[model samples]
Target: MTVVSHREDRVQAARSQSSPARSRSRTGSWRPASGHVFVSGYVVLLALFGLVPALYSLYLAFTDASGKFSGVKNFTRSAKDYRFIPAVQHVAVYLVLWLVTLTIFVVLLALVVHRLTSRRTKAVLRFVYYVPGALAGASSVLLWLFVLDPAVSPVSKLLRWTGNDNFAQVIVPNHLPAVFTIIAFWTGAGGWIVVLYGALNTIPTELMEAARVDGANAVQTALRIQLPMLRKWIAYMLILSLAAGTQLFVEPQLVSQASFGIVGNDYSVNQLAYQYAFSQNDFNGSAAISIDLLIVALICAGFFVARGRLFETD
Candidate 1:
């Protein structure tokens, strides 16, 4: 009996140790459950919004306006359409003009504003600059249309240099794109200037002091010390501006309206897509065009991501 009791006690002690081991194993397993829940929620949201819509758009691009499957017929038709090449070229030119001009102007303006102002003054200036960004799309375009009117414009003398009699005549068909680009920059640069200023503020004050101590002039300090530190922010701004440039509908569309027949109705890729979908009643072709623009935007975004210099590091 004594031997049997001793054996039973040993067995119980072993079971106690095994119970704690099992409990720890269960606890380890439970920790991953929260991780799984987070991952599952993310996947669900992606499918519901991002992936599903993208797949639907892809499917639509291969179909007719009547919802009948047409394979690549719509895409091929769009490619061979008369307006396709011209529209592509126009967008290429617009993108170049908008992106390059806006970047240079915004960066320079932001740098100047940051350098020559007190904090309170800079904030107020930033607010004033960003006010144009608050204008609704239609309002901004309308305002520019009036600003471009030669008879009423305060800058009539400058417009006369372009050999334009009136605003309408001044912005000839060929010059319309550049005119619209300038208008866009005037309203849009302010917001980007603020963005760049924010990035500029993040640079270490010690570095600026050190540069000053080394007898570096203001321009030298800005070019060598400040600008290099802003490379990532500049890259981000460029990528975003490139994306926005591809969606150049408002400027061209509004200008087309304001200029009557002076500017072509379908002067941009987005306008062309709208013409296809709405006027031509060809949803598939429009989808194809939209998908093409999406691809371009994706390529620009990918370039930024691959460079590993877009987002903030610290």
Candidate 2:
């Protein structure tokens, strides 16, 4: 009887050990419906804020300034508006500059930083890079306003080289595109570089080691191996930058405000819309400009979609 009791005790101990493992496995494997309640709330909010506003904008776009239905008149009027095309052109220049500079500088910097620095150093550099981005929007613009001021600027010599003796001269329409590009890069590229650096981390170490064995140098390895692996991330960044460029507002608006219209009023599509809606109280005209931009955004989105496979890995 005692022997049987001892055997039962051993069986109970084995069951206890196995039971916890089984429970853990079950718990680990089990996943509830993801974002169920969160997504439901999100959908409601999207319907209310996103869809409803979008529909109202579309409705307003088709109407005249006084809220009477006037099919396509607002759009046609915008087409003939002198500032319309210039706004588009300004944004185009800004986008081109932003995309080229952002991709080249961010990609190169990220790769070099990752390859040349230790992890701790990389972290510190990333934090430094992200500091300006933390300021963001109006605050960063305020800081740059000081930087562009010839009297107060640290780069006063550089500003004077542009022949810009005052704040107004610094933000001339001709220089706005380049100035905004630099500002955009300073405020935006840090975030992208951080993203690229993280993407670089996901690359398999074995591939890099193989390159090393094959006598590839750091630059060669980065360009030949790392760049290819970052195709998706680059594509993502380009799309995001394109979308953002189309919505150019805060920089130009702030520059115009702070510098007193030396940069002009109809500097960006968004500014043009704001001018109509708030300044002129022409909601229909504003909605029309907004719709035009919406169409442009949709076209851009389509372009990205058409090139979808370009971002995919082999």
Candidate 3:
């Protein structure tokens, strides 16, 4: 009878231990399932919004409107087009100008603002600077068009140095792009200044204080300490600016319209593509141009990723 009681007690203890183990196993399994569910949803959203469109565009780049595959014919044809080289050159020049302007003017302006004032004052200045960004694309281009005019513009005093009538014709073939670059910078640099200012604010205040205590001047601290700390932010800004530079459309497009055929219809790469697709009804050519732009954007993205500066710190 005692042996029977001992055996029953051992069985009960085993069951008690096994019960907790089983419960823990169930809980662990459930956590993985929940995680998998979340990952699945994320992948689905990415595929729908990102992957699918990208893949479709790729397909379009290789095919005609009738859905007949042409392999690399579209790409070759686009390259051979009369306007291709000039359009590429135009965009390249614009990119260089735009990126340089953004990097130099925006970063310098932000740093100056950071040094000169209190946080409240800086905030107000940033708002004032960013006001131009509020202007619609059409509005900005139209405003600049008027500003470039010798007869109508208040800045005609400055324009007269280059020949009032000749200067008013500034949007001529060779000089038009430089004018566009200046207009774009004036309208765009403010927002970037605000962005860099935010980055400047993230620098540790103690670092600045230490530098000051060590007898470092404000200029020394800004150039040596603050700028180095801002490397990642600056890299991010460069990538963004490069991407925006490649997407230059609205400025040239509106300028083309406002100039009344003075700025050629094919003045910009995007304008060339639009003329191909809408006026010429060449969807393949349009897709090819789009793919070319996409490749440039991808290269920029790849550069940021390869540098390990795209997202949060490694």
Positional deviation of residue 160's Cα in model 3 after best superposition, in angstroms? 1.2
How many clashes show up per model? 0, 0, 0
Q: Report lDDT (CA) for all predictions.
A: 0.82, 0.85, 0.80
Tell me the tens digit of each residue's lDDT in model 3 across 135-157: 88778888888888888888887
Q: lDDT per residue, candidate 2, 88-196, as tens digits?
A: 8999888888889998999998987798657788888899887778886888888888999899999999888978888778777888888898898999888898999
lDDT for residue 200 in candidate 3, whole number 0-100: 84
Q: How close is candidate 1 to the true structure, as a TM-score?
A: 0.79
User: Could you give me the TM-score of model 2 versus the true structure?
Assistant: 0.84
Better of 1 and 2 by TM-score: 2
What's the CA error at residue 126 for candidate 1, in Å? 1.5
Top TM-score hit? 2
* By lDDT: ranked, best first: 2, 1, 3
Encode model 1's per-residue lDDT on 121-176: one tens digit a residue. Answer: 88888999898888887788788777777788887777777677687786676776
TM-score of every candidate relative to the true structure? 0.79, 0.84, 0.81
User: Model 1: runs farther than 4 Å from truth?
Assistant: 1-52, 65-71, 311-314
Model 3 weakest 10-residue run by lDDT: 305-314
Worst 10 residues of 1 by lDDT: 305-314
